[model samples]
Target: MNLTGWIVYNGYLPGTKFRDFAEWIQRAAANQGIRTTIYKNNHLLSCLTSDSVGLVDTETRPDFVVFLDKDIYLARQLELMGIRVFNHAEAIAASDDKIASYQVLAAHNFPVPKTVIAPKAFYNTGADTIDDYQKAVQLLGFPLIVKEAFGSFGEQVHLIHNQQELTDTIQQLQGRSFMMQEFIASSYGQDKRLHIVGNKVVAAMRRHSASDFRSNITTGGTMEAYQPTQEEERLAIATAKVIGADFAGVDLLIGPDGTPIICEINSNAHIRNLFDCTGINAADAMMAYIQQEMRHNHGRLADLP
Candidate 1:
């Protein structure tokens, strides 16, 4: 009954409520008699084990790896090693890149915002500007969002209302990769945060912030208990499956048309706000699920093919 738990880092760093939530999960797992390991660096090479039944890393590797990052690159490496990574690499990769995420979700009939990937050349400074920005606006429309290809905690997400803002932001992000997406107007100020574990919707909350444009609690948003509608629950599960995440925090924004658009899918979701506001103990639930999966896999290994 030995369980090895690895956290990306401590949950006490500045503006990282999710990190705090990870710590809470670690504590809760300890209370349940599970062994845990916390990694301060965002590297997976140091955490692999030859005999451990399970391994959790914010990055990817072989040997029972559980990835906690939104990036999919690590998942692919782990998958290549024949390890079972939650949120398979392909799914994480697709979700990490906004343009790719929207394409995959749309292909599968998932509701996602209209999005377009700006050419890398556009940010080159020496490339033609009008054509690139025009293409972006044509595909994604005005009042758009420009997000760094890989970012989290709502840090690199931006809302651009007009051409001036878009130009300024693009210039500021010069030489960096980014994606442009149509801002869901109805989701202007609020959205639902759904936390999923295994295949079930474990805890859900409605997030709102008067002072910030983002609903992430790390961005100063307030959270309250929310009972997801049937459609919302289905969308959350579908998004998780599509993204290949065993556990995830799915952000669903209600469009002006009252449709829920998948704004973001967080592989390493924070549980502190949900726990504090809803009393759901998502950390405990996740630990239990991981342990159960480990046991199930170990049993199968004993039988061999």
Candidate 2:
């Protein structure tokens, strides 16, 4: 069976790490004999228009759509058309929103840090008066993290240590919906990222950055192979299940008390690091998974006929 892969993102400009990784994924898929296609965000939008626009042609519609940086809005439309999409739209939307992700994980009894959600308007106004400042403090104490609702690769995360810093940061973030979470100093310098595909933990790594607090490899962090404890694995799996992602990268922070708290669940996880560090053929596994799903679906259709 022929399988088509799509990388959903805006056009990758040269010299960006994301572009490099995207190309690597494409090459890996090619080596596995999968016909891959890259569709940018604007291309997907243009696909819906009457101009017959976008990279996806009606005649060449793919069997599976692997969204890289694509929006979650296309889930239902594609699902109804019998396309197998990795990380369905609902899962993507939920995981993309930090507040929503935390809520889902917490509801499922997954350990996450104390978090507070604020409207963009409230945060933009800046808490000048003591009462306003107190309100903000009451929600999340000092040494907190402020993050935009939707961002990737650790681009929109900020750490605030005091009232003045907090105030200044808030003022700077005007007009953005953000979430605040209590910072766990214990996890200040290190964290583990577990890459899960289907029900298996294919590869894992621990990231540490001397110059940055965020352990995202894309953000100048150093990566090493990680073999997590049984407890950590369990927590990572639970977090993945809650997010409903077939492929996920679960970030777990070690709290002061040695508890592993779920920080974030990435639906469209980067597989390059896992491949580079652990020698796991994650792209091949992903392609195989898609082929299996396609065969299963085809069988179901035949039975119906």
Candidate 3:
């Protein structure tokens, strides 16, 4: 077998985004002469029995998997079965949750905006069990960001201008995990994206919006190919390395001084937008990285077991 693999994407999600991601990788794999099959995550059941772990009543396993969905248990199970997974389960877990990500970044001494994670509050818990959230205001001040910990495309992010909005946001987000962060006014309507593969940036872009504070391309923001500064490149690569992502799209916001600040890291970032703006196929870089790491050209999957 010449590096047979599976590219798995979420099945429940509508639209073509997930399918497109898989196709891109498949095309790149074909160029490398490696065969890869596209699979919907649900089609491959995460099998668990009394004494063994695998996909339940499934087809023959591949040598490796490029997982595009946030299925931590399924990913971990694959690893247990002697298959290599790029941007492994732990990387996805850390990147998927905003609160967890910030905690890790802060612990590693990365430059992130001042943020405060809300404490655990359940539906059954009384309001008295939760803090008044005056602490978040005191720490982050006015015009801050109230972002849900597990959202994408900036849909669940909010800008709170004062105490009233902060209180209302917390009340609305009650029983959910979220964070309060300092809003970088300078970065409003603009940010940078760097696609990192194996400790280096393969493609970069600047996303800008005229009417919104968040500069996410999926949310109607515009983009242009960008040449990252030496410092920006270093920071992006370092951020990806810290989370152990084999490939990632790292988003950075401009600080007041025009320096870069870590906004977030995306373990399974879509490459289509970057391709449209930069004419760079990050999928190629991804396949190449996988080949190098697996030593596929050398004809072995020794890294897995």
Question: Top model by TM-score, which number?
Answer: 3
Q: How accurate is candidate 3 locally (lDDT)?
A: 0.90
lDDT of 2 by residue, 1-305 (tens): 66677766546444565565567667767877887887665555424556433335546677777766546666546655666778787778888888889888878777888877765464445545334456768777888898888888889998888888877766777677777788988888689998877777778888998887788877888889988888888778777777778778899998999989888988878777787888886777766666677788888988994
Model 1 C-alpha lDDT per residue in residues 80-179, reported as the tens digit of each score: 6566665566766776676666777888988887777766754456433655689778777777898887788789999998888888888777787877
RMSD values for the candidates in order, in angstroms, are: 4.7, 3.1, 2.2
Which scores greater on TM-score, model 2 or model 3? 3
**Number of the top candidate by lDDT?**
3
Q: Which ranges in model 3 have alpha carbons more than 4 Å from their true place?
A: 124-131, 296-305
Which ranges of candidate 1 are over 4 A from the true structure?
A: 10-19, 42-66, 69-92, 126-128
Q: Ten residues in a row with the worst lDDT in model 2? A: 46-55
Q: Report the error of model 2 at residue 272, Å.
A: 2.1
Q: Look at candidate 3 and tell me the lDDT of residue 132.
A: 64
What are the lDDT scores of the predictions, listed in order? 0.74, 0.76, 0.90
Give stretches of model 2 more than 4 Å off: 12-16, 46-58, 74-76, 120-130
Query: What's the C-alpha lDDT at position 185 in model 3?
Result: 95
Q: Compare candidates 2 and 3 on lDDT and give the better one.
A: 3
